[model samples]
Target: MQEYSIAYAILAFIVLVLKNDIKDKFFFSLTFILITLAGLFSYEWKDNFTAWDIFSALGGSSTIALALLALLGYLDYIRQEEEVSIWLHVKDDKGNIIQKEDTNFSILRKNCTRQELQGILGVIADVPRYELASIKESEFMKDIDAIQIGKKKKIAIIVSQEKEAYQFNSIFNNKYKKIEKLKTQTSLRIDKDSLHDAKKILNEVGMNFSEEVNIFTKMIVTHKGLSFEVKIHNDEVNDLTDKLQNALKEVARQSKEENL
Candidate 1:
């Protein structure tokens, strides 16, 4: 009975980990084998134990194990919420900051669903199938709510237990139709043309975009304006905004030098 209790407790813990997207099936099966071997050595089979007796053995420890798992999951969620952050900024044509807002990742993740994200992404870029699980995980894509491009356009990236997704919009086309987003790159100078250069510059400044990993990024350039959104990870709101502002300034300076 004691061995059964220990085995059930370990099984319960393994199930909890599996629930959190971590796989450890081998450990799960191994625990059962060890428990059965212990039972054989203990001469428990000689006691004529019925199959129904296993439930009684599992009852107490299994209950405790599940309770412990729930508590641990709750604590982990609280820690993640404390760490998640996003800083939204609006910049003018010359890289001057016009406005800003600070928000948390949890708030944004719950605000939208995956289907809506795909619709919005379709409007923003030519890419098809913009789902979260399909996206590769990377440093740049961690704990971000959204990124605003220029004064008018924006992209929001969100991840949830159910799905991961991204969406895009602009001041002029806040409710933009699917067809309207089909506007050609000729209408926009930067469109998809400058994404590579922008990523290269951002990488030079320590904001590396992992090509193999899914890092949500968008770039738009036109005769009217240019904007791109990149995910940032930092708990300190003010510090994140300061770093972003400095990076933008550096990018502008570089552009000016190239022109000169």
Candidate 2:
């Protein structure tokens, strides 16, 4: 049993080092506890083991215990910023807006009308007029819109049928050379009838779209005024700007690391 505990402790340390997810932390904690208890109850208690055996268990278990503490801190960091949102704006120095609200978001459901598009895009149309696409249902033209961000920088907004969001995303990728994609939560399922009601409400001012709409909005970013595609789990639209900035920085950091 003492040998088994030592082996388990060593294995757990290797796994914690290799895996980066939060779940791995839980795994390490469980294995650490089991090994600690096993060592306490096994032959080590009879004082039969050498100093080397005692040191091995203590060192390995202590490593895992410290890792467990770090993992808990990381989990709390994740919990602090849990909300679904759109990236309304991400700016760079020189006043060049890299990712702005108008250019960074698109929503697609089973059925979306022009009026609904107007309502969704209209919210941010005050200062500069939002360039709305004339509703088209042609075989080639999918429901999509464009919001200009800065000089030669634009974001595409697209709407698609259920499960077809990826297909639409592919279309965007093919058109843009370097694009980064960020995926947000799919809104609550919106039935066909509810979609119609949403169009009606969007046509009005005070009313808001119902939460039941099965909508998925992705932000496709341009790399260095070219394009780069990245996918991030969605959060609150209000808070997405910060997340987007973090993603952009991460990509840049990775590129730097790779070059080194």
Candidate 3:
């Protein structure tokens, strides 16, 4: 039993290492299944009257463990393949679906801070005006907004300003007769100062605005495909901007690790 336990542990470790190192799913699956079956059949079964001996007669404990691990690994591999398929299924400018291997689109990690999101948004927004597909506030959530940078990338930003939430909702819902009505209702206004500060943040991250930045009070933006959601808390804009640079650096590191 101790020998069998040691064998099972060694097999499991080998499988784990192979799963991480091997990128070709078909090859890995074939190799793993062959190895697992070989291990199972290599064991000799001897029948004894005792109950413990009966288990060994069917298949040694190590054989059963190896079989279970193979099954689990196969299931997990299928799940991973499905996820990759969904993310990689993207369309070209002509509305034709591009092959997964052909497309350069890489999915961003779902979990991102507001600052990190804003930084990404700022970088995308700094592109040529013709490159921007659309930018609009979310209809359902007041604090949530989306910007489509080019055809491939769409990002949603959700801020934690409760005061601005109601205003955005009113504007989006058509409750206000005129967008100018918002001027008197909210203390927070998009002024030159705010615009300048926003630009400064973008410049710090090596992104320069190619076109005039338009701050919209009321506009509808709808994105059908997958989008990365960014939730923002009530933090000072400058502080958020400063942290954004570091956050972006960390995100780059993580993305590189994942690709490896």
Candidate 4:
């Protein structure tokens, strides 16, 4: 309290530099000061001048550092937040993705008009000779309007031209409760019919499922952003799973022979 010159300057500089968090972090600090005059007036504790003098000596540098520290902290506080992750890893030799692959997420069952699902999948190939063809065709209700609802869904599935999507369509079309797909792969959505059936089956055939399965078989619908998934299994529900599997095996066998 002997001199307020240096104290005032340091305070001013900090106020300017840390104009942002000043109001919040002020009384937020711990500080104790002994006035030389007050101590001298009191006969009890007049010997603490040494500590005050030491702090006063380093006062300018400390205040500058504190202000700089606050500014840096503020920078980090408001720094652009990173995106929530939506990624999956496949470790097979041919499946290691070196970089993000170009993906086209289709809303096959969700926003899909029968016309759209019909467009590419070729009129839901009947479950006849397809090995795992769905026998529960009567169960799949046609909720053609499920996609346009105000609240959107989060779903995940590996997309390839090969089979799974087609298999489900072939097996469960017009039978299972519904098929809902995300509008953009960016917009995660799940197949409700499959999800329901899978959940029921999960409880019934507990030990039959993969112990290592990571995605949801039954998802609790919530929207804190990240949840994308699909159910994977072969059952009576799969219409063309048998045929598709056999055909795929044949293709693999032929390619191996050609290489020889």
Top-TM-score structure, candidate number: 1
What residue runs in model 1 are displaced by over 4 Å at the alpha carbon?
Answer: 1-46, 50-52, 76-83, 88-260
Error of 1 at 165 (Å): 22
Two-way TM-score contest, 1 vs 3, winner: 1
128-200: candidate 4 lDDT, tens digit per residue:
3322112223211223332222112321222222222234343323222223332211121224534443344
* Model 2 lDDT, residue 259, Cα: 77
Error of 2 at 5 (Å): 15
List per-prediction Cα lDDT, in the order shown.
Answer: 0.40, 0.42, 0.39, 0.34
Candidate 3: C-alpha lDDT: 0.39
TM-score to native of every candidate shown: 0.25, 0.21, 0.23, 0.21
lDDT of 1 by residue, 1-260 (tens): 66556555655665555433432254434444544444434334436777766655445445444555456557545543442233333334354554444432322333333344444445544245434432244422332222111111223333321112112234223222222211111111222444566566656655543322222223232322433333443234445345545655666666668789
Q: Write the per-residue lDDT of candidate 3 for residues 1-260, one digit (tens) a residue.
A: 54455555655665566644454465445554555454445545455356665555345544555565667667654543331101112234454543222122222322222344344444333222212122233341222211111112333333222112222232123221211211111122233534555456556665444533222233222233333333333233445445555644554555557679
TM-score of model 2 relative to the true fold? 0.21
Give the better candidate number (1 or 2) by TM-score.
1
Better of 1 and 4 by lDDT: 1
Worst 10 residues of 1 by lDDT: 180-189
Instruction: Give candidate 4's TM-score.
Output: 0.21
| Whole-structure CA lDDT of model 4 | 0.34
